[model samples]
Structure formats: structure tokens, C-alpha cells
Target: MAENLATASYNRRHDLLQRLRTDGRLDVSAIAEEVGISRETLRRDLRKLESQGLLRRSYGVAYPVESGAYESELSARVDSNVEEKMRIATAAISHLGAAQNVFIDEGFTTQLIAQHLPESEHFTVITPSLPIAALHWA
Candidate 1:
């Protein structure tokens, strides 16, 4: 009996993912209604899918990465560097004052520098170890 219940749950989760593809996006209430399950149950199913990185829950909407065309679009935007980070750093450095403090928040590009910074390009560096604070040298 437990096995049958588990199988039914697995089937329900599978069906929910497929339905999201056709539907573009869904909310827990709507999915619950469509699948004839409780809202809590649908929420649980969506959570499992999210843990697998197969779906994203934003705001009140659950969207399938491929079906909604957002996953690939976001990846494309992030893939191309366009030298934005380098350009910004250059522009920031152009303004010259003897002593000034600047900070860039923790993010992907800055984290790389934190791990390994070039010895040649010099500046009065000020960072709260923008990647991982603990790794900062004393």
C-alpha cells in the first residue's frame, strides 16, 4: 500500500512538470486545482523540482526553464562578458585622488580577483574580501 502511494506521488510529480510545460507557468493553487490535489501537496512537488534545478519559482509563478524560454535566455545574457566589468573598473580608476575608499559588493567577477589578484596592476585595494571574507590575509 505504501509502495502504491509512493508510485502515485511520483506519477503526480511527473505529471505536474509536464503540465507546467504546456501551461507556461503555474501557481500552487492552480496546479493543485488542475491535479486534483491539495495546494500543500502541489507546493511540495514544486519544491522537489526546484531542488533539482529543473524549475524556478519566482514571485507566485512556477515556470519550467525550457518551456518558458527564460532559462536559456538568462544563460545567454550571463555568457557574454562584453568587457563590462573591466570597463567599469577602468572608468572608476580614472578619477584620481590621493586617498579614497571604494567598494564593490560580493559577486562572481570580483570573487575571481579575490582568489588570485595580479601583482602588476597595482592600486590601494580596499575590499572586505569580496568573495569569501575568511580567506582575507591578516
Candidate 2:
């Protein structure tokens, strides 16, 4: 019975990870219902995934971590927590003082920050990305 339970646990966690990978994120209540597991059981699965560095969980959501080298390619990362990235970028803008020098990186999140920065705020923008530099023309 113990072995069976362990196998069942493994299968459930595997399925949960597969779901997260496909959707980029998972809703706890929805996954628990779909997996036919109790919320407590699903939470345990999420915790195990967290320890594996396969995902980051917060409240009712689980975000997948692409394995190795932070996985380059904007197309690969854009779908991952897009809303969260936007929120983070917007929050970062709040920290900038007006007319301060800001160095934006080339990552997708930084790109979002560059795009979303309010026109009312002025800054000396420094970026290595051609796309961001092109913003000067827009």
C-alpha cells in the first residue's frame, strides 16, 4: 500500500508539472480539481516541485522554470508569467526618480519596462538592445 501510494504521488506530481509546462502556469484550485486530488495533496506536490527548482509557487499559481542556462530566445520566455513580468516592470518604474539615469537590460522583462515607462517620467536611457535604441524613433 505504501509503495502504491508513493507511485500514485509520483504520477500526480508528474502530471502537474506537465500541465504547468504546457500552460506556463497552473491555478491551484483548478489543478487540484482536475487531478482529482485534495487541495492538501496538490500543495504537497507543488512543494516538491519547488524543492526541485522546477517551479515557483505563490498562493494559487505555479510558474514553470525552464531547465538550464535560463533558456535564451524571447519567444521561449515571453509566455512565462507575462502578466507577472509586466507587473514587475511597472513596479520597477516606480522606484526610478525623475530625470535619473536608467540602464535597461536586453531581457524581455526589461523590454516590457522600457515599453511601459510613463512619458511623464524622464530618464537618461542606456541600453545595448537595438530594439530599445530604436524606440528613439517612435
Candidate 3:
């Protein structure tokens, strides 16, 4: 019984994070219905996510802390599937050409490219994100 309840809680939290990742933000009513849990229970989950620095609660809504153009939180995006991102970045770099201009977006996957980008004077990189700019400059 105790173990079952703990497993249920773990599943709920995992689902909650997945929902946030897919939707960028969540409303108390919507998430409660989606998770098939009471509002109070959902609030407890939100509180836990907040404590983990994954999200922010405002009024009846919870928004990811790493909100960007895609509405996903930066920290959450970077921390999720790190190895996959690295693999993707490596694949993308293989297609790069010398003496060409490139524009990278601010998405999580694109940020990996910025991190793994080779040091080259031949390619010009343009990005609007300060963090990516810093990465390139560094």
C-alpha cells in the first residue's frame, strides 16, 4: 500500500513534467483534469516542481522556469536528454561547410550546436541569444 502510493506519486510527477514540457505551461484546472487528480494534489505537485526550480506558480497557473521562444524553460530543456542533444549536435556539425554563414535558433537542440561548434574563423555565426553569443565568443 505504501509502496503503491509512492509509485503512484512518482508516476504523477513524471507525467506532470512531461505535460509541462509539451505545453510550456499548465493551468491548475486543466492539469488536474489531465492528471486525474484533485486540484489540491496537483498544487502539491506544482509546489514540488517549484522547489526543484523547474517551474513557477502564479495564481492558478504554472509556467516553466526556462521560458523562451518555444515557451519551454531553459534549465529544463538543457537538463533533459543531454546525451541525445550532444549526438544531434555532432551530426549537425558534420554537415557544416567552410566559409559559410549560419544562423542558429534559440531552441535547446540548437544550443547544443553552439556548444559543440568547432572553433573556426571561416564560418560566420549569427544568433540573437546572448547565451549562445557568449558561448561562441568563449
RMSD of each: 11.0, 11.0, 8.3
lDDT by residue for model 2 (39-119), tens: 999998899888878899987999998775223367667888999999999899888866578899898899888987777
Lowest summed lDDT across 10 adjacent residues in model 1 is found at 68-77
Candidate that beats the other on lDDT, 1 or 2, i.e. the better one: 2
- Residues 18-116 of candidate 3 have per-residue lDDT tens digits of 788789889999879876899999999889878878788999988887533223457757788889988999999888866388788887889888787
Candidate order by TM-score, decreasing, is 3, 2, 1
Clashing pairs in 1: none
Write one digit per residue (lDDT tens) for candidate 1, span 16-68: 77788888888877668867988788788888888877688886689986643
TM-score of each: 0.45, 0.48, 0.51
Ranking by lDDT: 2, 3, 1
Clashes of each: 0, 0, 3
In model 1, the runs with Cα more than 4 Å from the true position are 67-138
Best by the lDDT measure: 2
